[model samples]
Target: MDTDAILALLDGQYLLILGAVLLIIALVAIIKLRGSVHQLGQEHDQLTRRLDTLWHDLDAMHQDDTPSLSGKSKAPTTSATPDTSPELLLAERRLFEGLWPVAWALHDKVGGFLRAVESGDPHSESRLAARNAALEMRSQINRSRPFFDAEIEGILTQLVDIEIKAHLTACQYLDQRQSNLGVSSEGSDVRESYRNKWRQLYDREANELINHLVSAMRKRLVRHVP
Candidate 1:
């Protein structure tokens, strides 16, 4: 072949090689991008589910207007005559009215946290709302600190710990689930391990702790005559 013709043929071969390399690079980029898009879709779907669950929980709490934890549905009516001892009367009123509602509020708060777990929704706002309500109840107890002695305070502290632990457990479970889902190579055994830890350790421990607090509180309150 002539010199110019040989050089032209070499140029054509170089162009073909370069085109192949570019095509391979484009395919790899597309694959990576598709995987990312799929991941984003999954994340969006999970968030949407969480939001829906939170809305449902809020609706349920709003609907349940009946008093909880209190033994009676309505307060007993008294004669028009007022009590002679104002202090005793106030204590009596608090025993009947304040304490029961506070207990019920705590119960409701726990129930809400459990429901959020059942729903598998970690909507921050819903969890925050429940936490804030629990805090308010805690504040009320603190304000009435003198009424409850050392033993009562200890039980209340235990109850607060239970509440805080429940929230932490739920958040940890959600985080683990999300992390497991993000990794493509994660094995079923790892997921199962997470489940076991949550069920056997986190949940069982929290349940036992809360039950202990409830029993302690009941025992302490039982001794009070007023």
Candidate 2:
């Protein structure tokens, strides 16, 4: 072949090689981009699922209105044909009225924390509020006991257990939050372990408390049945 023809052939080969390299680079970039998109979709799915679970739990709490702790629906009447003494009826009313706010406060605080967990609020303010509310609830229950009958007092005592659980759960949550922050050279696995532990603890205690509040049913507190 002529020298000019050989040079032209070499240039063509070089162009082919350069095109192949560019094609390979483009394919690699596309593969990496696809992997990142897939990862993001998975993360989105997880977040949606977490939110759905949180809503389901919270909705369940809102659906139930009846209290569970009452021995029976037997509040004294106020008619001329009195079922119980005026003072006794007043005491029962007081117990019911006092407990109304406590149940709501528990629900609100518990719901707050669960939402916080879903939202990834590391400070966990909802759990902290729940802790303080629970302590205050115990105090209120104690202070109001003097006016309540012995049977009523027993029902209120169950709430004390729930309150203590709330307090302890709050402490665990605070610890977990700080530990997860990694100011102390914590590893990813260790932080993840603590996070999972705190989430499970909060869910269990919070759900338990919600169920227990059914014991403080409004119907039992008031006299609606003839």
Candidate 3:
């Protein structure tokens, strides 16, 4: 072939090769882009599901805070009964609102402390928090004594006592466990078993007491509704 013709042929081949390389690069980029888009879509779906779960949890909490009254519905009474006077009812409602959060706080704190003890690494922060919660609960009850009837007040006292006992028992368990960390003896096993039994018993009792307290409070509130 002529020199110019040969050079022209080589240039055409080079252009074809460059175009092929560019095409492959574009295809690879497209594939990678598709993968990134798919990954983002999956992440978006996961986040949306998490948000939905959070919303559901919040709604459930709201429902728990404001329980509906069960059974008989009577017409609103025209005159204020001595016990159900508007002022007294308002005060009782406020007390209920104030006490509810503190009660649950104490319950959660004690429960957390017990769980931490069971896990064999009870955090000091958890213990202190539980103790403070108990004290706060007692103080709150005492402060609101005027709003509570004798029955409710008694229930509150019982709840506080049981919670304190549970907290103390948990602390003792942790202390014993720490003191005997390297020891392995039959007596140790027996003591461990005994502690476990008491812990379980206290936890069960506390749960029951909390349920009873809640039911009593609900009934008290419902009773005075005009």
Candidate 4:
């Protein structure tokens, strides 16, 4: 085959791989969302069963004049916050997993805009949307960081920092593009910077943290199931 044909084939393969990744991210988002709902349902069912058993025990105790021991669980602790519930923690982990899909989608949007600018179209609405999404995701991370363990929080803070930088570059690029002024010379550099950030988030730093959290959460969550 000629060199040109080989290059074209390689490009096609690269695109196929990227498409597969995007599809996987979309599926993950759906699965994690479902997992959160399912865990909630399980916890709710357990709570109802426990309540019913307590009521029955109370009735029997009244008739027999004996103490009730219907529930096998420990007495209530001072902290009844959802934070202490295993099901809620699992749901929280799944919910945290759900955020990455949005981050990946925003990565894709920024990538597309980078390509457009490279082809001389200047940055477009897509990049602006990506910037906004990154900002919103950062806000979400802030609200959620406290719920997680310290290790996870450390990874998340880094992710938020990257988001801030990426968004600032995007904002500046869009402003320059909208003015009659041509695309800035720094556009290529910023594009490269975001590409690195994407890799760090999905393939390296954030990926490792996600695996750890998932493993820890699953173990604890199973113990709480009725």
Candidate 5:
């Protein structure tokens, strides 16, 4: 071939090679883009599931806290009737009457303390009062342990346990919050979420236990009526 034709042929081959390189680059870019899109979709789905679980938890808490039309929160009621003598029934009723006030007071004080801590306004006085109320309730329960049936004793123990757990969780969250004050970090955010989750869980559990205790007490007292 002549030099001019040979040079033209070489240039055409170079252009074909350059086009092929560009096509490969475009394919690689397209694959990477699809991979990124898929990863983002998976992340979005995980976030959505977390949010749904959080919403369900909050809704359950709200339902537990709300009172029914009769000005009392709905709770499961026991239907069993007492089969004891009149004197025993009277004694049981009297004991329960004496214990109910302290039980309710303990619930109120612990609940108040938890609310204050969760709202970022933890008060030493409220915590102290709650501790005192718990002590008093414990003293009463111990003193009256002989008179309580197994079911009532179990409910009382659960109530105390729930109170202690709720109180401890609140204290831990408060301590964590104080330690992380003015320090904004990803680790702190994760810790905060963890503490909040535990606090809410304990609070919900406390409310449920109190409801169950109230139901048991009512069932016992209702047998005394008529």
Candidate 6:
């Protein structure tokens, strides 16, 4: 071959090698981009799952249909609080579980007390029932004494106020009905005045009960984050 022919052949080979290098570089770049995209997808999916979990927890807390303490095999604690961290859940769970049983006992005691007032029997049955309820409340407060810090104490105080109001309202209504049954000619005016007073007292107590229950529940609310 002549020099010109050999030079042309060498030039064509060089061009082919350059083209091959460019193709390889392109493939490597494409592979690296794909890897990055896959990593981003994984990260996005994890974030989505976490967000969904947080939403579910909030919904559960709002729904108020969670299992009762008795039905719950484990502690009835949850990460349902709003804007809470993961570490907070464990800490809160410990605190909440410790307080729950005592709270429930107090609740039941208050309920029983209210029912006794409603039973409308002013005899020994009523007095005994009231005494037992009061004893139960005292017992619960003593048992939960250790866990009752400022926050928990405040909550319990609110709850007690609610119970007292509800009991007084029901009792007032019962008392009014009982007193209105027997009236004499001379005492008719006094009985009527008493009935009116009881009615007013009942209304006031009912309102206070509702307000206190709402306030107590609101104050106990916690925030959680997923």
Give TM per candidate. 0.45, 0.44, 0.58, 0.39, 0.57, 0.33
Residue 193 error, candidate 3, Å? 3.7
Candidate 1 residue-wise lDDT at 147: 60
Estimate every model's Cα lDDT from 0 to 1: 0.56, 0.56, 0.68, 0.54, 0.69, 0.49
Candidate 3 lDDT, 121-166, residue by residue in tens: 6377887787778768877876887667766665666566666656
The candidate that achieves the highest TM-score relative to the unseen native structure: 3
Clashing residue pairs in candidate 6 are: 81-223, 81-224, 82-223, 82-224, 83-224, 84-223, 84-224, 84-225
Output the better candidate (3/4) by TM-score.
3
What ranking emerges by TM-score with the best candidate at the front?
Answer: 3, 5, 1, 2, 4, 6
lDDT of 6 by residue, 1-226 (tens): 8999999999999999999999999999999999999999999999899757644543333232222322112221222334345665565466556555555554555455544554544443543343344345444545665543444444444444333334444444454455645355545554455445433433443334334434443444443421
lDDT of candidate model 6 versus the reference: 0.49
- Alpha-carbon runs more than 4 Å astray in model 1: 1-96, 121-125, 180-226
Stretches > 4 Å off in candidate 5: 1-83, 180-182, 194-202, 224-226
Clashing pairs in model 5, backbone N/Cα/C closer than 3 A: none
lDDT: the better of candidates 2 and 3: 3
Worst 10 residues of 4 by lDDT: 71-80
Give the poorly placed runs of model 3, Cα more than 4 Å off: 1-82, 180-182
RMSD of each: 12.7, 13.6, 15.1, 28.1, 12.8, 25.8
Residue-level error in angstroms, candidate 6, position 93: 4.1
lDDT of predicted model 2: 0.56
